[model samples]
Target: MSIERDHRRAAIVALLLTALLSLPLSGSVLAAGQATPATTAPSPTPDPAAEALDRAIAYLIEQQADDGGFVGFEGVSDPGTTTDAILALKAAGIRGVATESLISSAIGYLEDAAGEYASSGPGQAAKVTLAAVAAGKDPTQFAGIDLIALATAPVATPAAGTPAALVGPGVYGDDLYDHALVLLALAAAGEPAPAEAIDALRATQAE
Candidate 1:
């Protein structure tokens, strides 16, 4: 999964570089051609971005395990890593091909591991929810758990002056990563995020 993520990151960088290069070329072309072109520039060469994306997809396919899950550094198939692989494949526009089979396997792995993830933490639930939503699955019914609810459930707040009060209500006692992921998951799932939670996150940034 890490490998897939790294590959995806590289693909993005390649795309950015391609865009930057195209900008100067576009200006030069306009300057050189004041009149309409006699012929269509003989079909421009293959895009470097597309090539990079193809390479990334191939690398991801090679890393897929027998069970459809992309094994992580731990040499185990877990929901987190599997989800990462799925998202990376989707980003590369690799659906409806042999890659789809790999994605299906990863989904199956996540479904089977739902019970374990449910008890993990809000962060895990948020990430899985985002993955499911990205793959066109219903986050509410994923792994028989309402992942959105699990990630957004409000935490009890202690009275003012108590140590627990420092965290604030509706923050879930989770760190910034959890809060940001929950917000991202909510957006991906097309659900409304709690305003209090957003406010709490904003307050934390001020500190």
Candidate 2:
């Protein structure tokens, strides 16, 4: 009798499970159950500034160096500059890449070169370190008082062809085109530009 009762109980449990599974459980029902309750509202039109910012970010991604680090001057190999370029992009809120492999390669270069140079000032290293940190890399590996000093200083404005000069005399200043790159980096980082800079950039756009 006990064995028969056990079998009956097992059958009842199986039937209940079958009934639950068979019930009409649509995706909408599941989604509603799992979602956090919230109020809905009408979507607003997109802002042109936001769109421009996104496009600028797209351009920066295009500007990424072949080795994963940013190149300030076309021919010069400066990791500090590269890190700054990356930081500026991050500050602008650009992320993800066309290819995962590309991002991975770029990060590897940043890791290897950060803290390896101090060309401009103690601040230059700091600026580059901030860029690395913003790019999701560990910033602790390359920490120094100089780094902090550089970041808080008034952000530098880049002029065309200035990058090479920053490298100093006899450092092959002609090819790096540092100024243009600095501007590009600042733009990429979305640093609130000087009034004139904003005007000039806006002037380039059309209705």
Candidate 3:
């Protein structure tokens, strides 16, 4: 299957797990005016959602490479794909023995790729920031670059009737995806997003 298909499946699995986890446990609540004796509640049946999530986790674990990264497009091991897998597993509450080693390896790969990611582009920087935050690393110190700053850097626009270009603070691309991802990364890093960036993104949306 394609990487995009895999991503969609992973998202579905995470959402299923989230929904399953939100369900109330099988138990009885006592009323304000209690009866003579409380009745025993039936044992909870096995949850199909939990079972599916376990299978998904196992599949993800099997896909993990020796170097700790997951396969992306064209079967290439990529940090972004690894990050997505890690976040998906996390969302499903699949940790401990089932995912500990996988998570550790992926984190190591991301840390090692920090420099390359920082030099790539704003999108890459945003993705790295998200991954770093997910792995409990500080984005400001990752690969010796402030990923948040790199992602939020403003692009230079040519000024009319002037030789000098004007540079302003905003998302690097000022496009929807770049702005949205950067904002997400900033939120994940516990940093406050700039109001101007939010406004800029909002203005670009189709009415």
lDDT against the true structure, per candidate, is 0.73, 0.51, 0.72
What's the TM-score of each model vs. the native?
0.68, 0.39, 0.67
In candidate 2, stretches whose alpha carbon ends up further than 4 angstroms from where it belongs are 1-46, 75-77, 94-105, 143-207
Largest TM-score belongs to which candidate? Answer: 1
Candidate with better TM-score, 1 vs 2: 1
Q: Which window of ten consecutive residues has the lowest lDDT sum in model 2? A: 169-178
Candidate with more favorable, higher lDDT: 2 or 3: 3
Q: Which stretches of candidate 1 lie over 4 Å from their true place?
A: 1-43, 94-99, 154-166
lDDT of 1 by residue, 1-207 (tens): 999999999999999778666775553355432764666558789988777777888887777787777778887776788878888877665433346666677888788886577557777888888778867899999878888778877545433443332266666435677778888888889888667877777776644
Model 2: lDDT to the true structure: 0.51
lDDT of 3 at 98: 57
Best by lDDT: 1
User: Which residue runs does candidate 3 get wrong by more than 4 Å?
Assistant: 1-43, 94-98, 156-169
